[model samples]
Target: MTVQFYINKFQALKPDKSSGHAKPHKVCLLLAVIEQIEQGFITTNKVIYNDNLKSRFTYYFEQLQQGNDKDTPYLPFYHLQTSGFWHLDVKPEYQEEFSALKAASNSNISRYVSFAYFDEELFDYLKSPATRHALKDALIHNLDSLEVQYQRWALSIGKSEKTVKNYVGALKGSISNWLYDAGISKENVLSIGSYAQYSVVASKALQIEEFRAKNTTGNGMYSAALKSYQSFLADVTQVNVKDDIDKILNDENTTATEKSTLVNTRIGQGAFRDKLIQYWQGCALTRYNKMQFLIASHIKPWASADDKERLDPNNGLLLLANIDKAFDLGYITFTEKGKIVISPYLDDYQVLGISKNMGVNLNQQHQDYLAYHREVTFKK
Candidate 1:
């Protein structure tokens, strides 16, 4: 769709304002336009009408010339395209400028874009810290299958093969521990099959009324599955490792000595060790070459967990002294799906400084651990 058409549609969608401008309405219209474009419901060519171009331009021009809200200005067609109108390719400088505009507009626009109206509540569910973590766990627990699912999703989204491969590989390594959570069971979930089918099943499972009307046991299972998937998404977006670890450490079940021993013993053992080797074969966190200096740090507190649970590989990460200390001490942690979660408890400068020093980036391999850490360790 052409930019002018989008503007008209946006204006039409907005509630009629006789006097002052409707900031909220305008923001909602912008969000709707972007969302429609993202879902392929609208295109650049269609946005600009071939015959009514003049009329369209005239309307936007009139709005700009007579609009009450001077702060929220409308861009001309050239400005919109040059400013990287959503999907259209633009020069690097224009892209940067567009990014700035988007950033500025995001908060206002996102407020009006309700997730309740979407086909699936997946994106909305992902907004939660716990749900994101659970989703990460689900993805990691079903890593091999999830990778294929991700590829399928990527393809459906029109991502290139190389991009799909990279995303799948990165997510696999990062969220390895997601499947190991206490409540999740292998029987309830399916992996190697079609993602579209899985999504359908998942959606069906989430239909509370239908599920309840069917078998009670089946309903429970579906509820559990939905919860697990929601948690996985939460892990992806919001799980925090350090806070969870701190909670574990402070739990009445654990002692200071046990905490220390837990830290010392599992720093390089079994699954944890293997995960560390897989994630940072050469210690990406510390850049330390010596194997002795590298250690697999647990996202959850070992003292708070059973021996078997502590040994689970999904609980660990390979790190150097500073990074390990930060993770262990709750100064730093990762989101459920390997995204870095800087503690608000720390100074902004400290967080930024540490992040710069560590050079950490979210990868698929860390998703499992990141989810666990977010669920069990992150503060909030």
Candidate 2:
């Protein structure tokens, strides 16, 4: 595959940033380098001489050189060299076995590539079991196509067919073992006609297994598995399964209610818990840390909102008891810039005690949420 393809995939994984330190570009370049190395497109020896590789490296290095005022210089070159990219120095004869061992070891070199250029939080998330599994599934599904592309590339670079076959076999075996461990069945593995097909199946299996794990119930894994299978059908087949699932869950006519019960229990528990965790057990507006004092106050009232709007964190706030009550009653509100807005009925003394004590100046980060509250939730 061309460098652009890898760049696009890596970009999808990046967290959305409006401004500030441009950490994503560094990460993108680092992953691109590792990807090239893994596919044997660039070796430690060749990297120093290749004009394309040098140009890419120079772009990131220049950004770093610009200093912290404009962008944080997350220098990844030293980390990359130290963390095994340099080991591509292993003779071409041993390259096949080495690549196989590297993949099978689950050293998470790709994640390390990310770490060399991003923040600690991203590194931690990538190492997380859920995220790691997702990435592995994606990589496994793409491995065959990558290998084929690499073969064509190697031929252009004057590599022999024997070496190419050996490299491809090693990559396949390593990735196959990874998929098997992630719950893909041997039958499905054997049925695949090509590496690309195998990858698609493995990706589906991982998604289904993840969804099921998060939704398991007394009816057994089978029911949750079926739900996940249905979701995959909706995604791959584009059949709009949400309405179908919703109808079953909401059907007043159903005498048999297993599907409805499972759907409600899963959606309520999974989504609510995720929202609570994201807000870090506090009220967003009041900065209320006490669990009992905080409520996950929805921006749009629950009854009036759709499922997507109701669950959005941007549409939710952590508010303390009295503040939440005041907000709901429109007795007090926040400005579009995040400053507290007391209702006309509230005296200055009361506003001073609450809003001022809380240091409620509107910072840039909270502006959007404040705007939403001002436009949609705040009382006049």
Candidate 3:
């Protein structure tokens, strides 16, 4: 449906001329939209004649433009209504007027026909990266835009195509939107390997395909990649497990004292918060003093605790959720000596907004739990 549909439909493009060259202008415009889709640029289907389309059309036009031919962007852009792959969208008031001129020649068609769309099947087929590339190959192979040598050259190299497309997408497409001052290149990011290997692609493959995490928990590559990407960004690994204490507390076999101290509503989660509110007025890591934004995250972890340890206010550290999630997931841990110990797995701690000076004031009792977490749970 993908390759055959494009070839058959595109090869049938009726040239306005009775003589020399058959300009593949409609195909070129279709290629422009396909390029936009592949780069994650266009969200919706309507190809509005806005700045985006104008710029894309110009880029493709320059690449495909040939000898003695003037820049006629509006030519096939309007005339493609005859082709099965595209149709014009005019205003309701212009419906009668539009239908009358639907079969007009290049010069007769108005530039005011500002919107066009791909047929539904053609649009859906172009959504896949691999399929999109194959279709482009078919277009150029049958009736090319550029010279055959340049087309073959583009198809031959891994580095050159990768590098050029990376630069183009970054400068003018969805990558620009994605990177938005993030100060990282898609080339460098793609070279980062499995961890951050484009979350969007991994997400679609994993969600629909039921991909599993390699050497880790959860289903799909996402479980691993997302955590890895986050770790890559934040410089520490994270484990997204359900709250184990909640599971233990719900067990009927669990003793009342154990259950009592683990329930969030039953003086467990709130009581720890109350104690922390009294003891430390700010987060240990950033000294961020907003109580509303702080969490009473555990040092020893609740599932590992006995009743006394579970209820002990001193066992918890007041950290912001940003820091707390990191602490909770073992990206960052504290020493018995109260110094912040970031995991070695992290690439750059600064990227995570974690200051080098992060620490907590600890007593003799808090030191014991910190030691256990540092040894057993810390990503180290």
Q: lDDT per residue, candidate 3, 12-108, as tens digits?
A: 6765443355454665677667655654456566776654454455444544444455545566677676776787777777677767764544343
CA shift of 247, model 2, Å: 12
Model 1 ranges off by over 4 Å: 1-264, 267-275, 284-288, 348-353, 356-369
Compared with the true structure, what per-residue lDDT tens digits does model 2 show for residues 1-380? 33334333443443323443233333434533433343334433333323334343433333222123222222333223333222223344555554565332223232232222222333333334344223323322322233343444333222346644644443355334445666654542322323334446645654665434533532333332233233322322113323344455566765444553333322232355346646555666555575533444555555445545555556556665446545654556676555577665343325323654343444454565556566766546
Models 1 onward score TM values of 0.27, 0.27, 0.38
Q: What is the Cα root-mean-square deviation between model 2 and the actual structure?
A: 22.6
**Cα lDDT for residue 147, candidate 2:** 39
Residue 139 of model 1 has an lDDT of 25
What local lDDT does model 1 show for residue 169? Answer: 40
> lDDT (CA) for every model shown?
0.41, 0.41, 0.56
Q: Select the stronger candidate by lDDT from 1 and 3.
A: 3
What's the TM for model 1?
A: 0.27
lDDT winner among the candidates? 3
Per-residue alpha-carbon lDDT of candidate 1 for residues 185-253, written as tens digits (9 for 90 to 100) = 233343423233344444544443444543264434334334334333322222233344445456687
Candidates ranked, most accurate by TM-score first = 3, 2, 1
